[model samples]
Target: MKKTLTGIFSGLAILIFILSIGLMISGTIALRRNEPVFVFGRAVAVVPTDSMVGNEPDSLDVNDMVIIRKATIDEVEIGDVIVFQGVNGSGNPILVIHRVVDIQDEGIITKGDNNSSIDQPSYQDYVSNDNFQGIFQTKITFLKPLSQMMSSSKSLIFGGLAIVLTIMLISEVIHLVRTYQDEKNEAIKKKHEEEIEALKEKQKQEIIEEILRDNQK
Candidate 1:
């Protein structure tokens, strides 16, 4: 029982740590990138492709963590990974993570690392700095496993963990309640026993007093 309780609490603590680190990473990036979607603009973006792998570009990996940095259109230089909003009809505000292949006076041209060629030929015209979210600067490790988890059967992963945690928490509560009730019942029983002993002592003293009165008579 002790071990189970300890394990449950320990798991919960670790999970909380994972969550806090993720939040801090994301929040810090969102703050630096000026993203209203996250508090403090410290948002993390995904490494969309492996172009940066052999390129020795920051040792980044596919699905690795990337910190977002809000910069002016002028600062969007070559080789930097930029995340931006795509055109209309895109679902859920598309976030395109691509390296800056070319920067022009009016727009930028981006390309995927693993792909055979650059993005749509119309890429240059679609580039909008006003819609830019942030540029990738650093890596965030805590989000990698979380990213994998969410990618693989997100509902099942989250639901299963939630169920397990809830069960453990509920069991702990029940165990504590039982312990408290047992202590209360034991205390009441002991109090009753003490009261009985006290009554017997009183009776003995009364009998002695009655005997003394009879002798005087």
Candidate 2:
């Protein structure tokens, strides 16, 4: 039972390590290209603003980590929260997360929950299928704290990866040593048993010889 539990935990650790590496690589690429990185049709984002904050349960807060799934324009409906690429006041491209208020023949109109009015058409324009990123699925409640920590200390992530690798290395070394010790002990036991068997055979032969001598006399 202990070994089984160890195996399960080790498997989880390895899986987490692999996921971390993939995220690191993908994040680096996204940074270079200035775009969100999606893995397996899903993307994670840390909320930068409280525009979606409200009294509702689904309202988003700053620093919250959310999971978004790739979706088409047809897959979204009114009131569905979505992430899309838009331009800021300075014409610089930015990502916006808002709830769809209305769907028009031309494009989709979105408004933030805390905002008084919909996004300005001149600034953001109507969201079309071309700039649609994904639909918000849910907030990552468990990893929200971790996300904040990582954002504050970028080195923490690499430090965690290092620790995981060290642990795995130590586990492998210990396993090898134990395996070698077990094999060595088994070999010693086999040799000792063979020696005892040989000694018993010699004594039996001597007894037989003694019996033969007595019979001859």
lDDT of candidate 1 over 76-149, digit per residue (tens): 78887777765323334446777778776657777766655665455423466676667776776666775555
Candidate 1 TM-score over all chains jointly:
0.46
Give the per-residue Cα lDDT of candidate 1 at 192: 97
- List per-candidate RMSD values in Å: 15.7, 12.7
Worst 10 residues of 1 by lDDT: 34-43
Q: Which stretches of candidate 1 lie over 4 Å from their true place?
A: 1-36, 48-54, 87-93, 120-125, 153-217
Quick one: best lDDT, which candidate?
2
Name the candidate that leads on TM-score.
2
Weakest lDDT window of 10 consecutive positions for candidate 2: 157-166
Number of clashes in model 2? 0
Candidate 2, residues 40-154: lDDT per residue as tens digits? 5666677767789987666798877777888888899998999988876688777899999998877999988998889847558788878888999888667667666655664
TM-score of 2: 0.58
